[model samples]
Target: MVKWIVKFRNERSHLWAKVVMAIHSGGRSFTTIPIKNSISGVWKNIVQLGKGSSLKLSDVQNRLEVKMGCGDKIFFWLDKWVGDYSLKDRFPDLFAVQTDKFCLVQQRYSLTNGEIVWSWGGESPATHTDMAETWAECVKLLEGVKIEKKSDMWLWKQEDKQEVFKVSDLRSELDGMDLIPET
Candidate 1:
């Protein structure tokens, strides 16, 4: 599941991933595809794995954070591009008010006269103190980010030096967990 997801994100030209994405979600980000809409067993399973609230899925998902480069493909609120947590999880109040939940990091900001101008989704900025404070923090978090002219990449958080995903590593980690119970 993780392999397929990684392929979908990293290897855009991969035949299997391309075919699955073409048929299942019509080239949309796999994560954005609603589980209810999925028809194929593999597609359904993939969506469930990505969206599931299970501890196993959550733990694995957290390790696969996006490293922003171009920022076109990385989701602003949904993907963990800013820090360890997604903006949605970090600032639920601001997320609740966002106009586009699935907006890209590139869409949230613009290069205006050599300065970065952030535009959070909404008709107008939040006025409520709680949301306002959350908005400020979110902006501050992004102040240091500068999108470069390279494709977005995913980093496996567990791997310190390599920053690469290995099936063996994942297998070992899963094996270490108490997956099977004595009956």
Candidate 2:
């Protein structure tokens, strides 16, 4: 999706990329051509191809590691980001004391003098004994973080260390799965 136009060229150099992009962006429908009610078998197959992968739960969970660029999409508490664990798991006490458990990465942290801090500004639960320790730990992790002006990238934490999502990689993953042949 980062380079949708150039990336989707086929063997014949036909630019079906637009159609593919539209399918992904426009609710996986026949958006390249206006469709009132019905869909063609070809379109159905195309849509099915996109949804046909049988990803395992562990594999799916492993894939949610977001490469935080600007902290736009990654959920702060719920997602696994830092130290191979979610904030909710790492700091259970803090999560229990948190005002908003569903906050994004950007919401829970703030940049102060080029250092990231665990800040809920108005009413931080730092007064509590347990929360103070949790805040300290969070601050430790946050201080090491470096955010740049870039889009947040949701990555699969499998063999893709570079964090680029590829359909071929998913196909390869599916190929390894043992399946009964259709008669």
Model 1, runs deviating above 4 Å? 11-34, 37-40, 47-55, 127-130, 166-183
- Candidate lDDT (C-alpha), each: 0.68, 0.55
Candidate 2 lDDT tens digits, 1-183: 112211331111234634543444333221212222344545445334333445533345455456678676556776776777777778777766566554667776667797666675324648777677667778788677768677576655556364566767666767887776668
Query: Which RMSD does model 1 reach against the true structure?
Result: 5.0
Weakest 10 consecutive residues of candidate 2 by summed lDDT: 3-12
- Give candidate 2's root-mean-square deviation (CA, Å): 9.9
Give a tens-digit lDDT track for model 1, residues 1-183. Answer: 666666566764468655665566433333533233646587668656645533355566666766678787677887777777778788877877777776778788888898888886965677778777778888999998877879888766674643667678767776776756779
Q: How many backbone clashes does candidate 2 have?
A: 0
- Top model by TM-score, which number? 1
